[model samples]
Target: MPRVSFVHPKGESQEVEAAEGSTAMRAALLGGISGITADCGGEASCATCHVYVAEPWIERVGAPGPDEDDMLDFAECERRPSSRLSCQIKITDELDGLVLTLPESQ
Candidate 1:
């Protein structure tokens, strides 16, 4: 298992353990973390699950693919170099302490 920390715009954060191989969006939703809407249900068709990978976690999570990048352009919030769709990030031991900052509107 790996752990993910979702940081809200208000500075609040929730850390939850997730099963390996599962998507970060699923973990956040099941953990009851706010700010990740995931309206497209991990299909990479919507940007509601947009999040910014913390500086340190960026490399670990890797960059979003073409489709995800396309959807990110439609996010309700401004984008950052670290922006990514949580649905595209899978939980792995290397990302055990991954920290994602939720967009204000997301």
Candidate 2:
């Protein structure tokens, strides 16, 4: 299993262990992380699962795909270079200690 830490805007964070093939959004939802709404259920159609890949982990997490990038434009919070829809991030050993910061809103 790989673990991911989701940090809230105010700095509270929840760390969850995700199955290797699952998405970060799934892990967050199951772990009761508060900021990731994942309204489209992993479909790249919504931005409710938006998160900022921490600066140190940004390269490892990579950039969002074209579809995900487009969806991110509608995110409740402003998008940044680190912005990514959690549903697009697959859990893997390489991302075991990944840190994602949540926006003020969804």
**TM-score of each model, in listed order:** 0.97, 0.97
Q: Give the poorly placed runs of model 1, Cα more than 4 Å off.
A: none
Clashing residue pairs in candidate 1 are: none
Each prediction's whole-model lDDT (CA): 0.91, 0.91
Off by over 4 Å in 2: none
Candidates' RMSD to native = 0.7, 0.7
Model 2 per-residue lDDT tens digits across residues 10-55: 9888899999989999999999999788888999888999999999
Q: For residue 20, what is the lDDT in candidate 1?
A: 96
For model 2, what is the C-alpha lDDT against the true structure? Answer: 0.91
